[model samples]
Target: MSGVPTGSSGDLENKDILSYVALGDSFTEGMSDPYPDSDSVPNGRYRGWADRVAEHLADHVSEVRYANLAVRGRLIAQIRDEQVPRAVEMSPDLITLCAGGNDIIRPGSDPDKVVEIFESMIAELRSTGARVVIFTGFDTNWQPVMRHLRGKIATYNMHMRSVADRYGCDVVDVWSMRILDDQRAWNWDRLHLSSEGHRRLALRVCEVLDLPVDDDWNRPWPPPEPRGWRSARQEDLHWAREFLVPWIGRRLTGRSSGDGVSPKRPELQRCERYRPGD
Candidate 1:
């Protein structure tokens, strides 16, 4: 969609938006899609949920300057080190965070650490006087594997809820909203979301951002079915057993590991170099 429609009947007009920042991992970066033109590199510009959110905001709000600093395969530490600093520097009026999935998938990483990082991030965001939005949910394909880590997810979400309550920020319950036991909402990799999944997520984010949802926005633009679906049960389990499990084992055992894995990229021309003063 081009821009998000405000629920109002007026023509699309820019509002006096100060600024907004989006920070997180692959999910926030829209890992599966091709990156936008503005990115410094192909990988740098994946059109994830952050892009969707920004587009929607642009349609309805006239005066917003939105910057998405999300990266694929970013863990909590990586976000803290890279994304958060840039976001804080922007001094945004609004901020959205969608992360922790990679951390959960990482070997040897404690789920508690995820919660701790989220809490710290929220605290820091609040200190900046920005209205914060936190997204909570996981793709259905990962649910089975996440079952072991469900408790940790719950705890992390609970912590987020408490922080939001204390700080008067918005919390989007995306997890309960999008995940359904009967349907598959993930891609073949069983990690990234399907296009339909991204649309669903974008709509929910629109709601949280208080943007208007049009018929097009709610119509499931990509259509979930006819694309064919996979039963999470029928998928290969060897990857989890051979790759993920062992990787996590090594992480827990204090072996140095790189960021979990790079995501698949669409073929595209490399963008111009990102210069601070370009």
Candidate 2:
């Protein structure tokens, strides 16, 4: 849908999404998707869909202001109480909010409660008069261990469609993006998207926003090499060591990946990566 509602000038196409604010958890913070000069991942410099979406807009419009307040490992409540107020203060022209993933995964958390709180937060953002871009949780049918949360994720996504419609917001429908279903689209951790996943997510956001972009999020991936049972088992063990362990540790200790981190770009500016040449 065009960013702006039916208008005399139809300006959503021509007008720049001058001010953009992204608020959520690691998904919005761009985890596992490192930037060229990425710092201690917690420093939050990873360039994910929000940043890429901003750059796409900056390319078309004269200027665009963007800020990302997302922090990895944050629950839905923290995002609502902390990031939402800051985002509303910014009064961005465009806002992308993708939280609740953290909550849905917690052992005892209720997906419905998470969505309830999440929608309320979105309403608060909508009150700012900014066009909100929402996302349904991705399908994780490929990840065996993560399958337990699949039902919860699906529940959240199902409610999300109606919630987005109620808010007049754009839904990116990550669940329906078949391209992301590919194993290559995900990082080794299987919990977060890889760089390619982020790129595709950026494309999907541009599509929803009705912006001009050349890339296709649905482009096919090359054939994969066959893996024997032993190697597959080894890969699973390594994944548990590298990603799952730390994730569970964080949940147990009450520490966060973004505990002391700040947004890479607190204010909007031209995305240098998009500029001509390095």
Candidate 3:
């Protein structure tokens, strides 16, 4: 439950990490955070934590080939059936997997069952001798409706830790990263991390990998602007109408935000670091 320390034995520091692949749901897909230099590009990509980590690795190594096989709204089963095999085939030097968030949040979902499938995916990925990385779901106890699901999330996180231990994998324990308790860390939808949140997570991942970083993941943010009850209620109403309602409707109809959406970067290609005003 403490902050992730630097220079741990689990670090992939000295490995010839020439290639990396990321796998999972919306969290791994990099939602709510648009690429910074995307003003000139229409429908620019969501550069999430995985991409940021890839960019950092690219800087340290010679031509770090990176691929992200994550799609938003994917279930654990979908990831196992769809993305896991492809990642194994690619045989990257490193792999990051963060699935099961969508499943644990769904109605009538069983954490045990979800983690069982997740463990299988981890087992297969480890078989390739790639250094595998996994993530724990964020603590949503402070959020509304989602707060009720925190129990399930915690259950899943516990199992994830045990599995990671058994599989010799690294973990970016999002649940223990208390700096993410701020509202500014979330996007308007409250489902995915904001740009700032993604940046912090990237730093955490780098720390786990024993990669060099210039910023602190635990750095404090500027003071938040205060809002009155009426203003807060109005914003909540707008969020429910614009995001919450549509999300629930899609679930009822068995539709997903990623119904036809493809992975942003499917092939193992060189990654460029994202810079402001580039």
* Structural similarity to truth (TM-score) of each candidate: 0.70, 0.90, 0.93
Pick the TM-score winner: 3
After best superposition, candidate 3 residue 159: deviation in angstroms? 0.9
Q: lDDT tens string, model 1, 1-278?
A: 11322122222233455466778777776756544344543535456556666666666665556676666657788888777776777777778887777676555667666777877776677677677888775534345655676666666667667766766667888657634332444555556776556656777777766678773433433445553335433445655775567656766786533354342221111122222211
Q: Candidates sorted by TM-score, descending order?
A: 3, 2, 1
TM-score preference between candidates 2 and 3, better one: 3
Question: Which ranking of candidates, highest lDDT first?
Answer: 3, 2, 1
Q: Give the better candidate number (2 or 3) by lDDT.
A: 3
lDDT of 3 by residue, 1-278 (tens): 12222212343445554788999988998887788766732253788899899988877876688999999899999999999999999988889999999899999999999999998898888887788889999999879869999899999999999988877888998999999999889998888899999999999999988899999999998888888999999999999999999999999999999888888888999787767732
TM-score of 3: 0.93
lDDT of 2 by residue, 34-82 (tens): 7766556655558787877877777777777778888877888998888
Give the clashing residue pairs of candidate 2, or none.
66-268
Q: Which model scores highest in lDDT?
A: 3
